[model samples]
Target: MAFDVDHVLAEATTEELAALVCGSGSWHTTGIPRLGVPPLRLADGPHGLRVTEQLLTQAVPATCFPTAAGLGSSWNPALLKRVGEALAHEAIALGVDVVLGPGLNIKRSPLCGRNFEYFSEDPLLSGTLSAALVYGLQSNGVGGCLKHFAVNNQETDRMRVDAVVAERTLREIYLAGFQRAVTAAAPWMVMCSYNRVNGTLASQNSWLLTDVLRGDWDYSGVVVSDWGAVYDRIAALIAGLDLEMPQAQGRAEAVAAAVEAGELSREVLEVAAERLLALTDKAASAVRPAGKIGHHDLARQAALESMVLLRNDGVLPLAPQAKVALIGAFAATPRYQGSGSSKVNPRELDRLLDTLSARCDVTYAPGFRLSGELDDDLIDEALLAAEDAEVIVACLGLPDAEEAEGFDRTHMRIPENQRALVASLSEAGKPVVVVLSNGAAVEVADWVEETSALLEAWLGGEAGALALAQVLTGEAEPSGRLTETLGLRLEDYPSALMFPGESGQVMYGEGVLVGYRGFDALEREVAFPFGFGLGYTTFRYDSLTLTDTGSVVTRDLRVAVSVTLTNTGERAGAEVVQVYVRNAPASVSRPVRELRGYTKVWLEPGETRTVIVGLGIDAFAFWSTPHERFVVESGVYAIEAGPHSRDLPLSGGLRLDVPRLPSALHDESTIAEWFADTEAMEALQARAVARTGERFALSEQMYTVVAGQPLRRFAMFPGGVLTAEDVDAVLAEYGRSV
Candidate 1:
């Protein structure tokens, strides 16, 4: 397979362009022939594969992959990579060039109705997993599309609401996931989100499209607008949005009109067309081979892997013969995945009732209680089921309707019926296991005390029932880590104080303090901490080594992590090693410790292997404003590595030298650090002052004065609002000030 010669086609494509665009046809329908190859099509992403009777039958058969929340629950990059490969196989088979997937939007709010389709609240977890998935797809002949490009944090007013995040926070948390995906996977396409960032719609924001995507990341892939996401086609093209999806016929003509009208440039159009051609070349020359995958089996495996056992008391891994009285309507009709685009038609689905029925005397009972409201009759039914059962399995959580793709939930409590049902079951003294299916974290404080065990099964797609069976039967040990913290309530969040601001331009008061940072900073203990998950067998960590010097670099210090397993519970299992780094003492307020690295290992009973995790400077570094670079501030770092964030094996005092000189700061550092020697700060402060002329800095947001002179008010009336006179006065003032 020869790679597309982009440089050649970029200029003329004379023979190539003649075939592609020429075949696509000209203004006069009679002038040119129609395109031989049908145009590429895209389906809904994020939740499930949204396809219909028309698109699926004709095009290449693409495999619909798991949603973001389910994938996040797994926390296994290797698994994500495999999912990408599998989806690619489906896409190639379906003749689908680009599988619209790997949505990397940050889970900004728990109330966000569409969270089931998204991954973690943390950017790194979502970014890392998404990147792996992308790599797997592109490695084959398919192009993986990383979607909802910028600050598409919510679903309500998603197409109209503006995400007014600061430049720093935008770079660090909100856009980090997309950035990581681009940097790691280099996908053929990046799908633009239908939302506004700052004041400009993402579709028309040059800062997001041109400055961030092309300039900063050097992302050479084509960027397509979400279907009907385009408003100003010319502005979108000028800002680096290459293709309008679904091939809106009038869009390109409008673009051409704009170019001829001097509103845009032929050069910009050429760049977009070149990028589009690059995608065509890549997709056309793929190594597609016929392969059959038992999607149900794979989905079941993924579901089992993704399920997190939040709480347990030696009552889990139920005996196959146990009279498990299953309660709740979700048992029969599972909310396998979220609604809206990205919905895929699974070959088959497994319900919890069917799974339990296959192995045990399952007394199926739908305790007819709405989630928040407990009907007396439903409570009686649930209690009756519990009366006879040795153990009870309560399939509980927000119904699909409770959390949809629009509007935030007013609160996070489980409905009254589910709560009442659980209370009745608890009183019966039956060992109970509560299964939760939700997109984001919910307040589980009330249910925590009574429930014997709790499992968070985020909307698993396809083999959801089978996956639930495996976890219950102990086929695959639960090892998924939590991607977000389960807070007491919405008010517990620091951002909850200021987010969803009045009017427009919501200020990012917390700056980069997101996810666990909010919980850690406030010293509030959440119901469940990030990375909290359980495995069937217990593992141990020892032989901790940290070398400042010698054969190993500081980053690769042979950090021996060993866990001797006796299969304490008569079952084969796997465990996820979560490594977090804390700057015990730092220049700024950092998350108690950020997730630095992690690993998932499978070990048999009585088996032991020493796992050595390599740490790097990048792990210690944060976005340093003063240094204009990723800097690892000097401090006594604590490297705690274990299963889950709270259950980490403590290792204290891994020290590193801090920056002491100005030369250490990169060329881009525009600010001064407090710890920096006075000489460095002095030089940087002087340079900063000179750069802004001590008057019109980047902070002022507009040109106010030149050099050291301050400009007079720009035609200000009683109120300082902009007017035609104000605009002229500003121009005049700047002219005189300069």
Candidate 2:
């Protein structure tokens, strides 16, 4: 039978819930079994799925993917999609229901260590890629959940610090990605973050959970709390966050008790129950109809696709059967993921040396440290191991403390011991492949300059080890791209000062300028710019077209873009063609260019094809003020489309031949976007969006009625989109003289 949440909840009682809550009958239910499902489920997530009884570690070994920051850097959506599919297959084999992943939090600051788990510094890429992952996972009939919903960008003080972004910026940058994922993928479940968004905690944000997720996006799935994230179950239920995970605290009967005390409404209770039952309904459905999947090979393939090659000299593809020196304790003891709520006790963990040894004569040296550096003795031993080896592969990077969630990292340097080991090994004049297993961006200048190759095997889970093995053995081509910039130094960013000095408040004086915006604003160069990553194969670019000029500045401007790509290698691979827009001249300082559109393509050896993407006119405009609105300023815009930001292959310019938006439209969006377009509401919004940041927020009235619709044509659709004739009809209805 199809699971009916409403019906299931109607049959549920406080007694039944209590019996299950205190560990009675496993909360088991009898329903028609789905086709593809296992008899019982063991789940994985926040990172990936899990199986067996042990909470952190389990029976089925899951190949862990790289952290969000590392995957984000790859900027390869196609690879992410493949990774998602592979995860789904693994989950099914493990009898897992959902793979809780593709963490979609914003990168509020660079101090965040888990940026590797997310994608893009911008919302568009993050949301777009997340949706792709969710879609691919569900393709296997195993649901994947989009996670850490709302402002959970930072890790240090993450559990307590409130992300107080302005309403407009919040909507455009932070929440936009989550909203997109919800609308596009409709993941089986959404896991709320542990932090507060706007003043109320995410677990209890009514507008966020109800008005936005369920109301706007109409998300029909269940909402799970980040482990230990639930504070008040009744309030969280009233606010519409359902299903506290790792099991609920003392509040399993809180809803019934609230109904008895008249503190919570029966309506709210039913709504929560329905949502919970709805989750079971979908899982039940997946059990009915199944899909075909190849779990083992998919795991290895995903890891291969997700691995990013930061730098490589002529020494890659280590001669198929080369005897290799795999140094570093990390080779044996891998840190697949950071510790905290998202951490899982995997059923199986694959170590790099273990996986690599199967393919060739791979010897190891215990050379990793509490830091990602080396000691003289360990280095000498590693160097000695490489004595007769054809290539030297050293696995070095951060440990749990360096990338943990409790505190911000004081420095972004490799540990002294690991540094000594790597630098010393580099002196041997042998091909040294340095594999970095970290989550955030690190200063690898020294290592890059000295090493023969660099591979970022970010906490690639169960499959991470074999993925690295394939890249070494030439079985698969490296296709991962970079998501964030790897600055030569941390201070290169404008948010540097505001970063380290966090005492209950951090000012976003940089405003809309973040990631590439900061780099473009000061004309400062980055070691690697945003939207950057190198592929083993090569591609070409040509053909740019800009179509449709708009009369109103804020109105849509359509521009078509095209590029020619050839498989400049013996092997076939994929590439992400990025389109960035440079504002010719603006009222205010703008970033060099913002990412507008991107497409991924695959090519066989010597094959060629052209790709064209459309650019919206609004992509050229930025917010000047709530009252002044967004003025195109009637200028030129430079369109650069290619593999990466700094690596633009084609460039062209187009004049804005448009008129400024009528003051009403700009003001309407500004006021509607932020509660502070006028000077009158500025102070109120500052306190709400900044002071208490997440706690205090703009009143709904301020978000809406401040400025009426531009011309009320919003209600119009198809032929009804108010032509002058429609306006005349409206005037007739009002009986007013026009």
Candidate 3:
């Protein structure tokens, strides 16, 4: 079962190595028969398995779990891990090796059509949840591929558009989650994105694929390109890409020729081939259980945890005897998943109309066409059905065409027809409960107040409808939180000005500000903030404490935070406790507060418990451009805790003693830079007194004019108070040479 990689690489022929580096077909790798490497099968679906049947036309039926957007709101990594384990069981039954999944791309913009497949807008949440999923899958003997590797945010012009971002922004916002996932879980494989980063395609960018991913993070896993991402096969290989996915004609022969013609090194070819052989060996030798496992119950529980109750006016938990009118065609046939490569053909799907009719006196009507067309008859029928009902339960969502994999959304509003149906039902003066089933946030400020209650039941897979019914009838409680901010309008987003850019490039002009970070920075009001959710019961936060758990000189700072939470209501429910870190005033711009740690807990009526969440060095650090690394300036940091981002009721402060980062100075260094250092300032003042019998001093008026001048320019000053020798002494003693 354990084969030596060096031995296999040494014995592999040039042709065999070339073939091993690329996939043998659409869903399999090319195995070396003589070397005992068996081909490994791959499948799609991050939330389920989608193994293709013969001719690659049809896929086997599998359990369709909640999409990533739905799962992200749960804020329960433990639940995601169980989902990953269940998915691994199905993969093992279908003879699959790697499941391409757990996409960790930041939700930079809500208009990104593929937002349904990603986790959260913040990096810490995304990375932590993805690491849990990866751990579950790999522990169960199946591989999890963490993907669309880096900054593949928008779908428009995805294959060719260049993502132009600054180094600090890239490190802090775009690449932070990937770093966390790689460092924590060590996924078996990482899939490169189709888009270009900076100006180089991800498949051939040595800096990203090699320097950062491999050299910086010390990742040893195989680097596979997204399907059809490789434009230059040899270039990708030389850039540290271990595999090219899918089947391509003439790829093996071209790779072999490149090596023979001295365009590629044999050593690089062998390294790539060795990793493939090792992957195949592990897959072929894995030991898995022999029977099937059921996950409908788990899927239903996940759906329950993922439903966010946005607003409630004491109308939720409808009485069992209350008559209900369920409106919308989606109630009968739900769009449970997004339309794209990750879509799965569910083994079974639950319908809300059917589930509700079985429990209470319910009337159903097709309120609007699935295409979002205005039909006068459907609207009139819906109004009539609501006349005799005690409550109107309206299910609404964006049509499949509005959000998909290949393009970006043009607007944030639901179809006017769906909006019209809700408006008509609200006029009846009865309590209206609007349940949304979209993959991302939709604008609701205009009409949300019209309804008595609003519930965000995202694209919750096959068992979603059953879960919604339970939440409505007091059988279950809503515990989901918002992973992305819901702004009042699409134009309110900071990224809206330059999203999906033109001219073959998109600029990340907002820098580190994305999602709730941008909203907090701009002091903008949103329909709902990140981590905001309402359950049946209320929780009070108090008793905040912070403890340092690691040494300061080691530069590995860890703070243990504990908060006492109490259930102050009459019902049993769950709450997601969010913890954020706010740095002291600094030179660089930062979010008002960044999410550092979080936990989900269940409490009975009048129950109290102390929850502890820890913060590491990365929590208080920012990417310093001058140092070209993550640097934490010594300062006192405020630790805030509450149920949501905006409603922090508990606060504590901790002072960290971080060593001062060294600044390299030279002849061209600014005069302000020299004065900022204590030692250099003393040297310059001493030189001034020796030359002119007076200590060095500059007036505010003079400083404004000369603060930006180079240190060497002081030699040109009147009377030569500070000479070139003085500048040289400061540079030599207190700074590195230029």
Candidate 4:
């Protein structure tokens, strides 16, 4: 007889129902064998499948794709979708039901140890890319778990730190990506974060899990707690968490006790059990047999597209016969991916030296160890190799120990020994091509100018070395761009002062100004701007046009922007066209420009194509504290078309006249705010001038003081002429006008 999940859930005792809500065995959820419900097996990570019955040892071999940081730089949703499909195939091969990632956490800080597993600093970019990954995985009969929900950006004190963020910042910056992913992809599961959000554990936060996620976003999926994230199982369940991972350690008894004591209602338990049964049904149907094809070639292709060519000076695409000196241990023993739970045990790992040697005459030396003592003899050997070579390619990056899960990096500089190696190699008079292999941004200002070319290969996976070889030899074009800004110094970042907070609290003091948005807002200089990359060829953007230039009036308003782009250079390559929107002066302060939309296009030499990007009202709206929602203020919005945030060559404008219902006048309202009501101001101005004479004049300085002061407070000022009755009459008139 076929097992019926619903029938079992409906008849199961309270103890059995509680057990089903928690994990049964390691990495597997409890299932009723009599009812035919099988356990849902989850495995490690966003980049690849790292599955093992044991938590700490002996992971099964799988295809290792580029980390999220590297893939994020690609900005190609289609490529990410293909990677997701490949991951789904591997998950099935490993007998895993849910692939536990496509981690959608925002890259709030460059020093965030787990940034390698996240997408970008921008929420829209992170959400759109992650949604594509989620869609691809689910379409391939594998369930994708969108994870580390809400403000789980840093690894420091990750399990307990309270991320204290403002309401507007939380909505616009921190939670925006997860919101986008939930609404767009509809992943089967959402894993609650280990950290505390505003002093409440995410697992037990009803507002985050139930009100915002289920009620506001209409998410019908099961909510699973991050392993060990559940504190009070009953509280978590009540908060809309349907599952506890890594097995039940007395949590089932606790849930049963709570339900028996009448503290937790039986209805809630029944609902939770129903959701779990639904998830089990979904998982059972999604299971498929593994395929025979290996994704090594696809991994290489992904790596090739993910590499951001930070700087190039005619030394790249070397002559076929140019003898090369390959320095640094990373070239021989590559740190292809990040450490921690996301680490993949690849079927095979490639080395840069081996890949390069297969194509050209190459001399190799371990210029520096990633950690501890550096060998002077090895440095001398590397110098000797560089002395004889026509060009030098040095692979240098942060070691696995420098940045990884469970801790945040203290600084953003490259390891000292690697820095020394680069300095010596660059001083050797041979053109140096520096290849970086870290997961996050490192300061290159110290030695970047000396290098002839720079390639940011961020923890590329098993085939990263081969991809690097191809790009170095001009077999492929460097199409990836920087997803986060490469700052000149750590102090230049907006969150530098309060990052990785202390005393169990991390404050998001920077608000919505994160990454390039922060840098642009503060006008800080950075080593490389976000969305900046150099390809083998050049492209020119011209003939900018806005299809809808009239006033926008509705929430569903959209403006179509078209720009003609041409490959001006000789080489065939790809270019990412970025579109940004700047709202004319509004009630709230905003970034000078925010990225609204972007699309990547491939072109032959001298090819021209017109790309049309659509912009909706959300692109022009801000999270309004007064309105308690996203609102578009009636104003002119400037449309900027560019290769990156800082380099806009084409521009257009749109006038939007969104209708907004004015709030009722109150004592707490500012004088300027009251004056916004023209009829009310007209009635009060004449009465006030008559009482105070020249003292009540609206001069620039006088406006500065009184414009922000509350109307009630101004009425009580020493020389004030306005009274409570006077303000009430004006408000009454304002209310009448409405």
Candidate 5:
């Protein structure tokens, strides 16, 4: 039956409207039977449906696909869309109206325990993949919720920590992904994060929810709070937060009292009721019949694409009949997904030992206990099993307690027992294939050189074990890539010193540089760079071309790039063609190169294809503090294409003549700005030297300090040679030249 949202809102009393804005039951909002409005049930997703029974302790069985970290490595939007659709089908089957998913928060630090739920460190990749997932979910009649709305990067002190970030940094790096997802996908709902942003709680930050999301991005959707994220219901509603989750006690009473006392406007309550009713109307038509949707096959396919081959020395594609030693407890009991609210009760989970034993002569041994002290007998048993086999596959990873949703990881190293197990297995005098299963990047620098091959299966969902077995035995190819940089040491990270924060605040000192951008800027060696991955076959890139190399001032202008890719090896494989743009003579400090566009393509042996990717004006733009918006400076930008960010094999240049005029020069402008005017620099310097004589013959330190001072301030110094008139003349000259 069709529901009228306006009629429902007009009839709702202040008490009813207040109750409607917040949840009436766990994971559900109250529905007005008198007005023909039904309750909306939300489910946890991004990978699978996480429907819980009473008390939220027991979860209903559902399909578990690859986690966001693993999916991000696939770099395949079409695949993500398919996964999203499968998740939506499950949600409908379970009587869920919305799926809380597609977390677009940037992987700012490797130590973030919840990195498995996020996408990539780069905004372009994260945003694009998130948009695809959102589209797929909404297409199936299920509402998609883009979550952790702003700078909820780390899990430590998440409920109240303040992200003390610069405005430009927030715009360019941290918030860019969310902006892209909101503008492109138009998700049905956006989940405000648990933490505070710039001293204001995310639920009550009007600049973020109202000014940016609803106003600037034109998002016409409900703004829901993270579970238990609401501190004040009336304040959150005024700030544009339409709903609070988990049915907080006394919230309705508090809201009604606030409205009656004139503390909260009645119009705010009506607007919130209207948005909730509208969402109910939108979801009413898409509800499907109640039945289980089998997604195990889809889960396996997703896991296959999400596995990353980090290092290989031609020892992969194990023979099906070869004798193999699976030496790890995880082989018997897999750690397929992370813990906390997003944890899924999978319908079925495949074990690598069971799958591999069915096809080959496999000797399995528990290398070490997943918890408790390591037993010497178990280590000896694992060593014996490894020595008797042709090849040893050691499954090593962090315990669930080490990395989860409540806190940040203190270090990047794997558990001590797991490291020991790998060390012992490495000495078995056979080929060692180290398979890492973790939520975030772990240090492989210690033992990576000794291992013959490495596979980074980042918390692949329920069918991950089957996918691992297939990739090992030549049933599938490893096509996934690194979404975050695998750093050599934890201290080497740009935000290492300030990670997890202290005293309720975290500073984004790295600015726009994060992940691979940081490694490139510092010229540091990483275990694996972003966008780096390997497959059985090799690809060669050639014939790079740019469609429009001419200048353009508007943001709407786009440049098309085409490159020929050839599979020169003897196998079917996939390749992710990454395009990066470097600003020649950057106007401000920026990364050496930023990822602009990328696409994954499959090729047969000896196949050749030309891939074309378009670059928008935002690709070459940066957040300008003076302009309070993104600006593309008039300069030449070099576009480089290759397999990864660190290895660009093809290059082309495009000159953009943006029509953005420089800001009007004033007396408060830095002295360095005045010196940059070549027409006025010589005259000003000569006058200074003539007036101050030897004092004007300043040292480098003095020059540095004086150059940064405002022109007006420098003119007021006791022995200052330049006056306000001289500064005015310089500005007049600059204006004339423009």
Candidate 6:
């Protein structure tokens, strides 16, 4: 029988409603079978699906694609959408309703263990890519869940740590990506984080889940708790979290008891039950096709685009017949995916050593163990292989123990023994190429200069090795850019001091300045800037022109931009034309430049293409604390177009003439605020002139003294120029305008 969500919601009793809002087991939502509501099954995803009915760790075979770090670096939203569609097809085959990911948390710190699952440090990039993925997933039958809703960055004390952040910072940085994805994709579900935001737990933070998510962003999706994230079930439900996962024991009875006692409204319970039933209906209605996917080929293609060629002294795209020495244990057993619940059991996994051997004259050696322990025999064998080979390809990365979902990394350096091997290989008089396999950015400043080439093949899944082989042999190009900056040291990061705070509270001291924004603001030197990648070919950017497409009367503030891109190098390649915006003097401090929009264009040698990117009003707006919303202060904004953040050759400016928003005045508003508002200042001067037949006047020095004081407080002074009644009338009149 086709499930009628309306009928089921009407018939469900209070007890059944309570049960319906909680999960039945680990991966299934609670369903009132008596009311004809079927359970919706969910599985862990973002990279790929982990569908398991028994142990969560042991899952059926699914094609694991490149992780978000890999996908984000690709800077191709269209590719992400295709990947999402492939995931949806696989999810249907595995009997899962929703795939719980495309984790959009900003990569605040390199030490964050779950950085693999997230897209980028920049909210615009993460949000844009995630939205594409969501659109693709839902376009097919399967549903995608946008997860760890907000500020769930680090893994250290994830379930209990308090993330203390300012409202502006939250709106601009941490929560911005989720906001973008929610508004753009409208995913079927949004999973609340485990940790507390500010002082309140995320599960019960009404401001985060209700006021901001639903009220402001208009997210009309079911809010589910991260597995075992709920502490107070009644509070979580009341705060707009509709469902509790992993079957919270006794919570359903407690909810019913609360409703019976009038402590929790029965209407809220009914609303929650209605949302669950609607979700079940939506899941059941999706018509999934029979499994017909060449996921392995897609994984290979994605992995190829995800490989970032960090640096090249012209040694890459090695001669196909060249003798290559394949060093490091990772060449044989690649760490292609991240650890923990998001891990996938690949239907087929490729090894770089095998792929290289099949293509060229390659010798293999275990330079170092994955355990990071020193072994003299392995080092000697690797050096011997390098001695006879024309080129040395050393595969190195963080071991599984170093980075996972449970804890944060202590440092950004790769294994000590691996660093030792790189040093040894450099002395062999052969061109050394370093192939990295970590999920997050690692410290390469110390040893990167020793190698002729560096390839940041971040946690490419399943067919990653085959992709690496292709890039090495010139069959494919390394087109991925750095989503996060690779700083010289871990301490260089803005969140280094406060990340995973000591006493259960982590302060977001740096505010909105994160990733390249922080680096650019401080003029800090980094190993690699964001949106930086070198392919087998080079490209030139010319003639950047921006046309104001929006009207000032309507306050649209949209700009249509076009940049001419030509492939200067011999080989065909794709370049990600990044468009960054810089606001002309504002009241608040902001990043020097923020990524507003970007587009990837493919070009052949001497082929020119005009790439168009549009900037909306949000590009020029900043979250104003006093106004309590995103406002674009009237000014000229500098628009820059380039390949990366640091290398912009084309620049233009757009003057926005939108009216400044009236100050939100109140009794507590400072005297300076009143004077700053032209209308408010004119009204005060008119009243003073009516009484004394002269304009209101105060000495510059005297105004400075009283500028910080509240406007109403001036009336309290003995023999003050203003009376209490006069002050009240001004406030009453001006407050209405605001």
Tell me how far the alpha carbon of residue 50 in candidate 3 is from the true structure, in angstroms, after superposition. 1.4
**lDDT (C-alpha, whole model) for all candidates:** 0.68, 0.67, 0.89, 0.87, 0.86, 0.89
Clashes by residue pair, model 6: 46-102
Backbone clashes under 3 angstroms, per model: 25, 51, 0, 0, 0, 1
TM-score on alpha carbons, each prediction: 0.83, 0.78, 0.96, 0.95, 0.94, 0.96
lDDT of 6 by residue, 1-738 (tens): 358877877787888999889888789988788877888898988888888885455888888999999999899999999999999998888778889988999999999999999999999999999999998899887888898977999999999899999999999998899999999999999999999999999999999999999999998889999998999998898899999988868988999899999999999998888887887888888777775444999999899889999989989899978899999999999999999989998899999988989998999998998888988789899999888899999999998999989989999999999999999999999999999999998999999999999999999999999999999999998889889999999989888988878899999999999999999988999999999999999898899998887665576767888999999999999899999997778878989999999998889988999999998888998999878888888788899999999999999998887776765777777788777787877877778678767765669999988889887778567665565566667778776423
Residue 661 of model 2: what lDDT? 33
Q: What's the lDDT of the predicted structure labeled candidate 1?
A: 0.68
Q: C-alpha displacement of 342 in model 3, angstroms?
A: 0.3
Worst 10 residues of 2 by lDDT: 21-30
lDDT by residue (tens digit), candidate 2, 547-604 = 6554444465678877777778877888888888887765456667888888877899
Please write out the lDDT profile of model 4 over residues 1-738, one tens digit for every residue. 235666886788898888889887778888877668777888887998888887898787888999999999999999999998898888877777788998989888999999999989999899989999999888877888998987998999999999998878988888888888899999989999999988899999998999999988999888999988998888998999999988856888988999899999988998888888887888786546565336999999999989999999999987886799999899988989999999998988899989999877899999987674667887889999998899999999988999998899999999888777887887899999999999999999989998999999999999999999999999899999999999999999989998999999999999999999999999999999999999999999999999864444545677888999999999999999999997689877888999899999999999999998888777887887666677778788899998998999999988777675555566678888777766666677777777766334567888987798887677776666677667777776654222
Score candidate 2 by lDDT: 0.67
Question: What's the CA error at residue 730 for candidate 5, in Å?
Answer: 9.8
lDDT of 5: 0.86
Name the TM-score of candidate 4: 0.95
Please provide, for model 3 over 386-493, each residue's C-alpha lDDT reduced to its tens digit, 9 standing for 90 to 100.
999999999999778889888989899999999898889999879999999898779999999999999999999999999999999889999999999999999999
